[model samples]
Target: MSRAAGLSRRQFLALGWFPWLRPRHIGLAGARFRILRNGRSLRRYLRIHGNEETARQVLERHMETHEGIAFVIESRTRVVAVESLQLDPNRMFSRVGAEANLKLLNPGVAPERVRRALDLLDRGREKLVRALTPPRGGMTIALHNNSSAYSVTAEVPISDQTSLREPGNPHAFFLCTDPRDFETLKTSPYNVVLQQHGPKQDDGSLSRLAAARAFRYVNLEVAAGQTERQREMLNWLEWFLP
Candidate 1:
C-alpha cells in the first residue's frame, strides 16, 4: 500500500507537523518544535517593526498558516515567541558546563579524543566537588559597566559543615564585549577559564565568568563603557589561560 494509504488514523495524526497533535509524542517533539515556531514568529515580528497594527495583523495571518504558535511576550524589548509543545523530563536538554560544550568545538578533532579528554576533566571536577565536600559554594562575579569594579556573590550548598571554605584555587574567565576585547582577552596574563568568548550579552556575562573562572582569575570587558586603549589592555590579560 502507498505510505499515506497504509497509515492508520493515529499514525496519520502522528505524522502531521503540529506539535500538540500527539500527547504521547510530546517528549520527543516539544522543544524543537517550539524553537522553530518561536524563531519564525520572532523573525516575522522583527520584520514589521514600527507598524504595530500591521504587525499584529501579520502575526495573526502567519499563525493561521501554522498551528501551535505561542508568543512569550515578556516585554517590549525582550519578547520570545514559542509554540505549545511540552517536553518530557527525560528528554530535556543537558545541564553540563562550558567545559563539556568546549569539547564539541574544533572541527577536525576526533570525537573519541574529545570524549576521552572530557571524561578526564569530568573526573577531575568530580574530585574537586568531593574535596570541597559539604557546604560547598558557588560564586558569581559581575563586572561593572566599564572594567572598573567587579561584584562577587558567593553561596554555599547547605550541609553538616558549619563553614564553607572558598575554592582555594584562583580561576578567571574572560568576557570580551567587542572584537577588540576578544582579541585582548585572548592574549592576557589571566588564565583563560572558558575556551569560548563573547559575541555574548548581559545575561550570559555571569555564566561566562563562572565557567571561565574554573581556575582563579577571569578577564571581563563591559561593552557599555569600553575605550580603544582599554580594549588593548584586555588583550594583555590572555597569558594566564592554560
Candidate 2:
C-alpha cells in the first residue's frame, strides 16, 4: 500500500483497460473466494453468493474503476461441497449456522462429523474475518441478487426503521446495520432499511457478525439479471456516501 509500490495514474488507468491484476483465490475450509483489489479505500465490497451473477458482475466492474477490495465467492452455484455435505458459504460465518447448514439436507450425517467440520471452519474463519473487517473509519458493503419472492418487504418485518423511497422496486434496496448509515441512506432515492440490532437467532450471516462486532455493514440487493441497474446504484452509493 505504500506509494513506492503503488501504481501510477497511467498504470491505474491501464489496469482498467487491461486488468493487470488477475483476481487471486483465497480458500477457507472447503470454500474459496476470489479477491480483487485496486488502489485503496477504507471500505470493502463483497459478493457473498456465487449464483448472484448480477451482483458479481456489477462488483467486478466497480473494482475496475474504484478503490478498495472486493471478495467474491468462487463457485457459480449457490452452495459448495464441504466434507461430502453441501454448505451455504454465507452461513459459514458462525459455528451454529454452519452446523445447521451442513445438516440441513444431510440429516443422516453424523453429529461427530459435523463437529470436526466446524472445528476446521473456526480456524479458517479467523483469518477470513480479519481480512474482511473494515478499518476504524469505514464500512463493509455486500452486494446480492434476490428473486422477486424476496424483497425489502420481507426485510421490513425485522428492520428497526425503513425508508421505502423506491416502493415499486422492492428488489433493489439497501439494508444497513448502523443507524447513522441508515439515516444517511434514507435520504437517497432508493429504498433502505436499518436492522440496527442483531437478530434474535444469529443465522451466521456476515451482517449478523458485523452487527455483533458493531462494525458498519450494508447490503445492496438487486433483482437478478439487472446488471446495469445494479451498477448505477453502486455508482450512486459510492458517489453519495463518499
Candidate 3:
C-alpha cells in the first residue's frame, strides 16, 4: 500500500490495529499536525481551517496547563490535506467527502489525479481517525471561528435537539454529536445542538465521522477574532464534559 505523509508503510499498518499509541504527532494523507500530549483524556483540534486564528489561540492557551492531546495544523493558511489541492482538511475524513471536496476545489483537475488523491486519503483516514479519537471514550472537541452570517439556526434543521439561549447569540454556539453530552451542555450559557443523527447530506466534516463512529464530538464555534469567547467555551467544555 502507498504511504501517507510522514507515515511509513509500517506505521500505517501498525496504526490500523493499534490506536492506543500516544505519539506527539499525527499524519494525514500528505499533511501533518503537531500534537501536544498532556496526559488528559480530552482530545482537541484547532485550525483545521487555516484562517481560524482565534481557535488556534484558544488551543494554545488551553495547552499551558491542561492534560490532553491537542492537534494543531502546522500552517496558518492552508486547511486542506495538500495545500496545492485546496481541499478542506476537515472535509477529507471520508471517501465521499474527499471526492466532493476535491471536485469542489479542483474542478478542472484530471480524473486520474483525483482518483490517486482520493486513494491516499482513504488509506490515511483510519490512522488519523484513531489518533484523533481518545482511547477511553473521551470527548473530542474542535474549536472554530466563524463569520457573523453563520449561526445555530443554520444547523438546527439537521440537529436532533437544540438548546438555544434566550435571545440567542448567533456569533457563538456548540455543535455536539453525543446525546448525553448535548443534554448536559444545553444548560450551559452557550447555545447547544445535538446532531446525533446523520444528516441527509454528508459534508465529510470531522463531526460527521465522529458521529458515524459514535464518538463524543463537540465543536466550539465563535465569531472570528473572538479569542476570549472561544477560550471560555473550551474551558467550560473541559469542566463540563467527560
TM-score of each: 0.21, 0.87, 0.85
lDDT values for all models: 0.29, 0.85, 0.79
Q: List CA RMSD, all candidates.
A: 19.4, 6.0, 5.3
Cα lDDT of model 2 by residue, 14-47, tens digit: 6644555543777777678888988868989889
lDDT of candidate 2 vs native?
A: 0.85
Candidates 2 and 3 compared: the better one by lDDT is: 2
Q: Over 4 Å off in model 2, which ranges?
A: 1-23
Worst 10 residues of 3 by lDDT: 16-25
lDDT by residue for model 1 over 1-242, one digit each (tens)? 38868889898867756654422211111111111142222111111111123223333444455332222121222111112221121111222432233333334556565555445434443332221121222211112222223311111121111111222312223432233333444454432223233223212222333333442223332323343322333334422222
What global local distance difference test value does model 1 have? 0.29
**Model 3 ranges off by over 4 Å:** 1-23, 42-46, 81-83, 166-168
Model 2 worst lDDT window (10 residues): 14-23
Q: Identify the runs in model 1 with alpha carbons over 4 angstroms from their true place.
A: 1-100, 127-139, 142-221, 224-242
Give the lDDT of residue 177 in candidate 3: 91
Q: What are the per-residue Cα lDDT tens digits for candidate 3 across 16-77?
A: 44445546577786466888766545565555766788888788778888877788877676
